[model samples]
Target: MNPQALSPRAKRRRRLQQRQTVIYGLLIAGLAVAAAFAYLVFSGTVPSPWTRPITMPEKIETSETMECPPEGAYSVAFGSVKANVFNSSNQQGIAVSVAGTLREYGVTVAEVGNWPKFLRTDGQLQAGKAGIVAAYTLQQVFPTMQVMIDDREDASVDVILGHTYGEQSLIKSGDFPAGVEIVPPAECVPEEEPTEDELNDGGEDLVPEDEETEAPSDGEEDAEA
Candidate 1:
C-alpha cells in the first residue's frame, strides 16, 4: 500500500492502531516485571526493600579467671566437714536417709530438713567460700550432682535432693576417696540476642483474626427492636 494511494481517514486509523498496540505491549511488560518482583519477595529469595539492615555487635574476648584457696590453705578431712541435708523431693524422710548416708561416709550432718523450693535435677551441693573443697568432696561422692556457689561466709554446705533422688548413693564408700581435686570458679558468659529472622521463624501467631458474626434474622431483629 502506497501512502499516496491511501485516504486521509484510512491513514489516521492505521496510526491509531499502531499506538494502541505499543501501549498494550508496554502494559504487558510492566505486568511481567511486577509478577517477578512479587515472586522474589514471597519466596524469600530477596529481602523486601522496606526492611532495614541489621548490625550485629562485635564479639568480645574473655580471659579465663580462677578463684582458688590461698596458698597453704589446708584441705579439711571429710569426717570433720559438716553438711546440711535438705529434701526437695516428695519422698518422706529422704533428708534423714541422705543424712545417714553422709554419716556413713564420715561427713557430719549439721541439719536435716526440707528445702524452700523443689530442685529440677537429681541434686545440688550449695557451697560457700570456705566449703569449696567440701562441695567437691560431695561431688566425688555423687558424680552426677551439680555444684552451686552461694554467699554463705562459713564452711557449711547444703545438700538439696531433687525429684530423681534415689534412696542409695551411686558411689559406695566407707571413707572419702583420695585424689579428688577442687575446680576453681569462673565468670559466666553472656548469651547473644536472636536475629530478626530467627525471632520471626517461631511460626506462632501472636494475634488471631476475629470471626465474622452471623446476621440476625428479620423476626429476631424485630423482636429485639
Candidate 2:
C-alpha cells in the first residue's frame, strides 16, 4: 500500500490495467448508443433515409380546360353548335319539329320548348359572348335569324323562333354549311373575348328559368341541352 515502495514494473502494470478498463468502457458505451439509435429507427420515432419507403413527389393540379370551339380560333364549324330551339309561334310542336330538322342538318339540338315573348320578325339566336361564333353558325340553318348577346356563360345558344320562322321545306339541306368555316357574327365586337370566356367557364353554365327545354331522347347519353 506504500506507493513509494512499489516497484517501477508494478506501476507500469497498474497504468496498463487502467488504460484497458477505459478502452472497454468506451467500447460498451459506443455499442449502447448504436443500439438506441437502431431501436429509434425501427420504431419510426426517428427517420432514416436508407430504411424509409420510396415515394414519388406530389402531383400538381392544372387549370387548363377543354372547349368545343377552342380559344382564339378565327373560324368554327357551322353545325357544331348546341342549339336550344324555342317556339315563339302559335303552332304546336313546332319547336320540337324544328329541333329535329336542325339535328338532321348536323346541328346538336339541345332543347325544344315554347317562348312566345320574342317579337322579332326574324327568329333570334341568343347566347353569351362565349357562344357568339356558335350563334353565327346556327344562323346559317335559319338564314333570317338574328344573333343576340346575353350574360349567360356557356357555348350553348338559344334559338327563339319568331312567327316568321321558316317551314321544314324552306330549311334546305344546303344550309348545313357542310365543311364550310363559319366566321364570327357581325354583331360580335373584336374587343369582346368570346373564346376566353368559354375557357374560364369551362363550357359549363347554370340553366336559365326561361329555358324549359325538352331534349330528344338519345340512347347514348342523358344530359341537358
Candidate 3:
C-alpha cells in the first residue's frame, strides 16, 4: 500500500469512488431535510407563508321619525285609539254592553272587565300624554264623563262606567271626524232553502238513452204523422 507502488489507473478509480460517496451523502442529507419540512407543513406546526388578510363590514345606526299634530290640535281617528272599558258600577253586564257600543262606533276597545278598587266615578276617561287626543275624542261621546291625566304610558284610554251609565243607545249621529263614523254591524241574510226538485236531482245524470227510449202514445204518434 505504498503511494508509489499503485498504478495510475487504480489511483484515479479510488479518487472517483471517494467523490461518489461524498455526493451520495449530500443527496441523503438534502432528502431528510425536505421530509422534515413537509411534515411541519402537514401538521400545521408553523404558519404558512402564503395567507390572505380578512376584512369585516362596519355597523350602522338609524332613527325613526313621525309627524305629530300641533299642540292643542286634536286630530285622530276613533279606530286608532285603544280604549279599555271597565264596569265601576255595582250593576252587572254594563261593561260588556258599553264596550260593544264603543266598538260599533269604531273605537278600538282593548280591555273589558271590572274597574280597579281605588278609582270611583260615574264615568271617567283616563289617559296619558300620548293619549290626550284620544281622550278628548271620547269626551265628545260621553259629555258628562270627566277626562283625567294619569300614569298610563301608552296611547290608550281607560273608561270606567259609573252608576248612571244606562245610556245604551250609541246610534246618535255625533260630529265625529271623517274616517271615525259609527260603523254598524253588517246585516246577515240567511241563504234560501233548496227546492224539492234540486233535492231529487241528487247531483247525477237523469236523462234516458236513445236506445232505451219508450214508444209514443197514439195521439202523439198521429200528431207526428
Instruction: Please give, for residues 124-181, the per-residue lDDT of candidate 1 as tens digits.
Output: 7776657866776776677667666665777778888888877454466645554544
Q: Name every residue pair that clashes in candidate 3.
A: 122-162
How high is the CA lDDT of each candidate model?
Answer: 0.69, 0.66, 0.65
> In model 3, which range of ten residues has the least summed lDDT?
57-66
**Which candidate number maximizes TM-score?**
1
Show how many residue pairs clash in every candidate, following the order shown: 0, 0, 1
Regions of model 1 farther than 4 Å from truth = 1-76, 167-169, 183-225
Model 3 spans with C-alpha error above 4 angstroms: 1-71, 118-120, 168-172, 178-225
Give the residue spans of candidate 2 off by over 4 A.
1-75, 168-170, 175-225
Question: Per-residue lDDT of 1-225 in model 2, one digit per residue for the tens?
Answer: 997788999999989999999999999999999999999999999998686554321222211221123234443564567878887777678778778877877678866777747554656777766886777666666767666666677788887777766664235566354445555544444443556557558667656679967766767565553
Relative to the true structure, candidate 3 reaches a TM of 0.44
Model 1 steric clash pairs: none
